[model samples]
Target: MISVGGYYCSGRSNGHHLQGVAMVISNRLQSSVVEFTPVDECIMVMRLKLAFGFMSLIVVYAPTDVCKLDVKEMLHAKVASVLDRCPQRDICVVLGDFNVVSGCDRAGYEMSVGPHGSGADAGSKNRLLFRDFARSQKLRISGSWYQRPNPLRWMWYSDVGNAAKKIDHILVSTRWRILQNCRVYRSAVVPIINWLWLPSGSISKLPSGPMITLGCFPWTG
Candidate 1:
């Protein structure tokens, strides 16, 4: 299985680009496509009872603008449920705009600014949960730096400079052998031609081949 993720910052100024992405991706995948949620981000999430092993994948886009209290809570709740459903899953990959800043895997790709507050209702709570959940499941967060587009300013109505941090990620479960960490690369991109503005030469090219798999050979254990 393969997973793709990108941030759709609700800047609301980029509706044209979002529409383009939907069209291109939809046309490429199989007609058996499935939607995993009532939300915009979801995976095909097919189950294959192969002779070798079963395969499952989940694609999630954490609620945008996480400074919003309700959105943050909704993300944590749904994420916990999604992981709970697949424990020993063979090939599980979770990717998208998590909008989370703290919580790095032990291998150390994510550089978390030490959360600066105390209490059950502060920034620390987010860091604590983000780290704890991944560890409890034996899931692996790619410890290597994956490419992410530059982050925009904090969306909160308040100024918390340190709160600004990376939110996109590519996480895989404990099942697959990571043949090469190099497969995960972030596309450092600038939108030169937005199709929404110009039709002929306005389309931006997505960087080719991030998170590559050698082949879709099934696992048997």
Candidate 2:
């Protein structure tokens, strides 16, 4: 919970400190926070009081693609339950590392995925599951709707630095066009993906508000 200029909320597994997810809200926006709930080790929900309406931020870190089918199904079910509990009028956002390769195919999933996704693992099991979940929930995969450089496209790398893949995603309610731009910053020091949103007006430190940029970076202990 080391957020220099913000408030940090994290959820960790009982014996696994590295297997969890966290969220950080800027100090300026701290007063708008309504409640924070750690659904489990891998999922967290934060509600905020915004100018226009309420907002729900569901941050998650799903299991790897190699995990068992039941495990992946359970994760998606939990996430879906969380979304269902949120108010229908609130601006809902789900973002984090899904650890599933979402390939560059927008034929059947045009409403969920966009045209600017990477061309790897086109119809992987995890990819289909992810896309189907998005479609079922009527959420748009906002991160894949932009064209970025090759370096900025991948979010994870292999131990030997020989392979890389894009496993991070930002899903927003399809009814709202709040996502302005999404970018992945792969740094040698700090690896983070930033999902920018310009909802209506400006905030204290961000460009626009109601909902601002949410950075779901990993904080190792």
Candidate 3:
């Protein structure tokens, strides 16, 4: 069984339009969902009760690099607001299609991003903002820390241009030394393009266990 969550386009009298963000949770994990909130069409936050404490998961679909600067700023502000409200002790994990590339620049940002990023630098303001946000939150981009093959690292591929980019990401709070491994999950038969796996582990000998496996696919339709 699968539990899906997201914002659905409202049906109007003129026509039915559906352009929104969504997340699916398996039945085994559904029981842990404490609450979920839809911040807007582009963002959603879900909380889950763990064995020892709680965890906050934020899912976002940011505007593309071509969008107006104000639009991108507004979205980030909204996301930050939601993040501020989360409990300080809760393990926070942010994941989604950020539409921004962190690249392989792991100079001063060694704490936030890693060296396994892909694609050329488009010099997008969104990318800068995302990096700054991660730094401010003390969150580490989990996928970037590990080295993977080119095809496995890139989350978005342009068929027309024959280009691939690593725009999707999974971030975890630095305080929790819980993320054991993170990588893109690819399969010939599955429709899911990006998947993150976090194995169960104890935190500070507190037995704060919750093995979270998340899969995300870009909404093309």
Candidate 4:
């Protein structure tokens, strides 16, 4: 395994050999890390000391629509536990490949989600689960708030390559204002593509104080 940053933490799953979650703490940010907890292959939490107080960043990879209901429920439970542990006053940012398409319907979820979301799939239970989590945690769906071009909004494409959907997302506390510049950067290429190429869906930036950048890429076998 190649290591780029200084501190590395990971959680591996026994059932699926390739299923795992990891976080690489940059040397510059290493000193701010209060604690890092890897709940399982699908979830991890990192607490950092900020100028104001503390900040909790929870990264997750939820099961896709094909996964069983029990699997999705378990993942949500694990994520909720981590959020519950975070102090209420601290800023919380939950992000990653949710694998759920939150449609552009902001009827009842006007405060939590925006109307700029991509079209949603009718049969995805993951969508409902995500909405519930956002409501419970009082977190706003950061990705859905920005109005961008169609290509920038879609984070996943159909296998046949005809259609696209916004499956990945970044959810942050509503207290922070999501700048208009926050958008998904599609077609971004890594410098080491000559030796090892990875498909990247989007690069999202939280252009707030100090600034935080997050990238979402799914691994395909």
Best by TM-score: 2
TM-scores of the candidates in the order shown: 0.46, 0.84, 0.82, 0.78
Q: Per-residue lDDT tens digits of candidate 2, residues 1-221? A: 22334555465646456656767677767887877877767788889887657879898788887898789989999999999999988888888888886677788888888888764745477788888899899888876788878687777779999998777788888877556777776663222334344454532234543435567754444
Residue-level lDDT tens digits of model 3 in 1-103: 1134532221222333333455677777677788877665677777888665788888777889899989998988888888899999888888788888886
Against the true structure, candidate 2 reaches a TM-score of 0.84
lDDT of 3: 0.70
Candidate 2 residue spans exceeding 4 A from truth: 1-5, 12-18, 121-123, 187-211
Highest lDDT among the candidates is held by which one?
2
Query: Is candidate 2 or 3 superior in lDDT?
Result: 2
User: lDDT scores for all predictions?
Assistant: 0.37, 0.74, 0.70, 0.65
By summed lDDT, which 10 consecutive residues of candidate 1 come out lowest?
A: 190-199
Off by over 4 Å in 4: 1-9, 13-17, 178-181, 187-210, 216-221
Q: What is the lDDT of residue 42 in candidate 3?
A: 70
Candidate 1 wrong stretches, greater than 4 Å? 1-54, 64-71, 87-89, 102-123, 143-165, 182-221
lDDT of 1: 0.37
Task: Please list the residue runs of candidate 3 whose C-alpha ends up more than 4 Å from where it truly belongs after superposition.
Answer: 1-17, 188-202, 205-210, 218-221
